[model samples]
Target: MNKVHYLNSHVEKFREDIKITIDVENIGDLTHYCNLHIENKKVTKIFTECFHKKETYKDLIKKLPDTVERLGLFYLTTVYWIAYTCHYHNDKFDEAMGHCLDSIDMDVPLLNSPHFCKKVYYYLNPIDEVKC
Candidate 1:
């Protein structure tokens, strides 16, 4: 089994969500994967329509602090990419581990900054994305 690492930010509903964890082996590649894809139309549409905040990726990026916004958008877009691949393209997450870990890395930095933590809560709370 591949080793795994958890992100400090996670979704807690009826149960905690493991969606933020990533394979340890892919840690080195996270930045590459994240940088490769900046704009996703499908995820953008979902964020704008499904969520009440009416947040397009760029909107969230503009409103939050640079580091916080980068992490948040990276996290959101990565998850959206995974969902998009699974639901629309029929790709299993295991086949998309690179992207998954990239998104997970986005949240790793927030673990160290209290300010960013608060910002993460503020940014994520509106979308029902996670708990601090």
Candidate 2:
């Protein structure tokens, strides 16, 4: 969310429920606002791409930290857009912010990939399960 002006975030962690509050500068001329939601792990409830088994989604969430950590700028940006879209639509703010900060610990990456690369563009349409 480079173009996005990050404002603040709040987290409420309980035994079974984890809620997150994220505030980002809105697109266009809109004022900043907060988007909040609780964490959900349902496979069919998050990713737009379909998986044959629920375990795959679980595994994906499990591996998200390593994946984002290892991602080049291009991929990270891709993920950010997905998260930003999640925030924009307010479908799954927790999942979006979770992936945004790497779910295990809420720490933003200091500096993203520094390699000079071409801008990449991705197009994802909203699906019944996940909104792009």
Which candidate number maximizes TM-score?
Answer: 1
Off by over 4 Å in 1: 1-68, 98-132
lDDT of 2 by residue, 50-125 (tens): 2213223234344343323322323334434544444555776555555545532435432222221112212222
Candidate 1, residue 129: how far the Cα is off, in Å: 34
lDDT (Cα, 0-100) at 103 in candidate 1: 42
Candidate 1 residues 35-60, lDDT tens each?
Answer: 43555544444444433343343554
Off by over 4 Å in 2: 1-76, 79-87, 103-106, 110-132
Which candidate number maximizes lDDT? 1
lDDT per model vs. reference? 0.41, 0.33
| C-alpha root-mean-square deviation, candidate 1 | 16.0
TM-score per candidate, chains pooled: 0.27, 0.22
